[model samples]
Target: MTKHFKSAFRQEVAELVVDKGYSIREAAEAMGVGKSTVDKWARNLRKERNGEETHDTPISEERRRISALEREVQQLKMEKEIFKKGHSSLDVGLNEKFALIEEMKGSYPIKSLCDAFEIHRSSYRYWEESSKKIRPEDLRTDIEVKAAHELSGGSAGSRTIATLVTSGGYDLSRYRASKSMKRQGLVSCQPPKHNYKPANKANITIKNNLNREFSPISPNQVWCGDVTYLWVGDRWRYLATVLDLYSRKIVGFALSNSPDSALTKKALSNAFKARGKPTGLMFHSDQGCHYTSLLFRQLIWKYQIKQSMSRRGNCWDNAPMERFFRSLKTENMPKNGYKNEALANDSVRDYIYRYYNSVRPHSHNLGLSPNEKEGFYWKASNWLARKG
Candidate 1:
């Protein structure tokens, strides 16, 4: 090793020379070495006992020298083990334990050793599976990870398996999970559910180009648009609305005898021609046929505006509209069907223009009146419509 470690052993010889009361020549003979070695140590011991420093000092760092000296001091005691009056510091039995672990194949878990050694499970597997490659070292660890995944119902992702490996004391990042699992031919077994509806927004050429993400600082920043069906007399009547989610208010709406592109366009036109559309605004709605229809689709584009559609087949995608429908069914819809068209029409108006906006204590709108919440998001998104 370093010169200081060797010099430390020499220092021990100097001490021995004085303790044994031997002259340089006699000690040199006992040590089976030259007289010069004993003479130098003799001179060094005299200088040290006289509190004088040697000129030929070691050049290593002081800590290295100190550690070497401490190790030498411990070794001096170990030289006189058992039956000697001097103390013995060596654990004498340590090598036996090391040899046992190194030789026995399975007494200790391979996985445990792998973790202790911080070796990869994949490396262990590669060796185990090949007669040419089987590493006697890694076979146990590689098998355990695979077993853990199967035992965990295949629901366990790589992260869980990594945690299992860590419990054995070896740490590994989950980055290797996919690679390891792929080699094992493990596939998560689950049948896929079929959904029939098409996503109109899937075509990039015709997709929603306007990303209408907005923060409503005031009531009219962005408006949510949607249409729901209601039974009036013998036919289907549709109610279209423009809602401000901020206050949960139905600002502009139309009562129509038909569910058509015209119905939805009328609702938007009324909101824009009346209150003025906000600038840089977002208009979100479900992907109902009317909302995605070419006619209404052009209307939105003609205005040079942004449009957002709920992901296809995702009903909760338009949560604000979902809440509006719940309110209508619970509070305004007829117990069975409307007694007649005229009666349903009138009741729908009163609820939308008056009770729903003015009296409903919408839990999600933070208990505030829709009119009170509207101005905040409207002004915040800076979507003030300049045109009718």
Candidate 2:
């Protein structure tokens, strides 16, 4: 008595060789049978199909029924396998289980799989329908949120992104947007807090006139100046920025290797010239040598600008400028700092003029970018002036 393939295996192999055009060797390898055996099977199948006599064994009714039942069991096992693979974590609760059942819908009846897994078919169907309902709108909002976050250089959190999206005329909440971001695996970068030593007090003369009045009635009425350090190359470099409080936009900025009065003066001069030598501007800064220096004060007087200083060691007096620095360093600064001065300069320029001022949404600016906020103000003002 020689061993032979079961009827199903024999037919399947024969079909592979004769009907499907597979070589006898290929069919034998695939079916785990010898080439000679596959060749014989292929010939017998072809002859049988052609109504010629063949030597295949005639199976009894009991044996046939057993084979059919075995086949049904094997098929069910394979379908069940779809749920078993890649779902071993204990966190796979009802939602995850429902997901598995939905995936097996086409392969097996929903009722059958749910009954086998002890899941309610009604619950799974509800989950399926509910998903379909929100999928379209959710997809649109998800894309918008992701775009806003990326535009902020991965620095915008849920609140910021919600503000940005809503400005485009879509109603969105920070919490809802945050949920969408989480579902899409998007997270904002949060830099660690840093504190720096205060500079030597200002000449006992400069006054703290601005007194934390961070909001101004009009652009250029109150411009705040500040200097911060950046890690460049093997040493620290300084960046001076002058922000127009009304628009919350950085009107002028200068980067230097020295943190001195000259650096702060340069930033002011840039802002002064950029704003067409505006007068009656209240320039506020901390009592650093830069802002309090005799030379810098003279430049402020030349523009007929008033100078205001922050209280000693108190950053809150200049909260707008401090907040801007926080956003810049946390959201835009490179993780390892810049490789050199030139790279640092370009990076800072891009963040200020290209991204921050023009693209990023600001909460205080009613979700508009700094530039957009100013533009809106001027547009409306001009329209009102014309109407008058």
Instruction: Give the TM-scores of the predictions, in the order they appear.
Output: 0.43, 0.64
lDDT of each prediction vs. the true structure? 0.62, 0.82
Residues 273-314 of candidate 1: C-alpha lDDT, one tens digit per residue: 666755665678876788888999898887665787766665
Cα-based lDDT at residue 214, candidate 2: 73
**Candidate 2, residues 77-164: lDDT per residue as tens digits?**
8656755652643256787777777776787777777765667888887888887676778888998998888888889899888988
Worst 10 residues of 2 by lDDT: 55-64
Error of 2 at 304 (Å): 1.3
Query: Whole-model lDDT, candidate 2?
Result: 0.82
Looking at model 2, residue 361 earns an lDDT score of 79
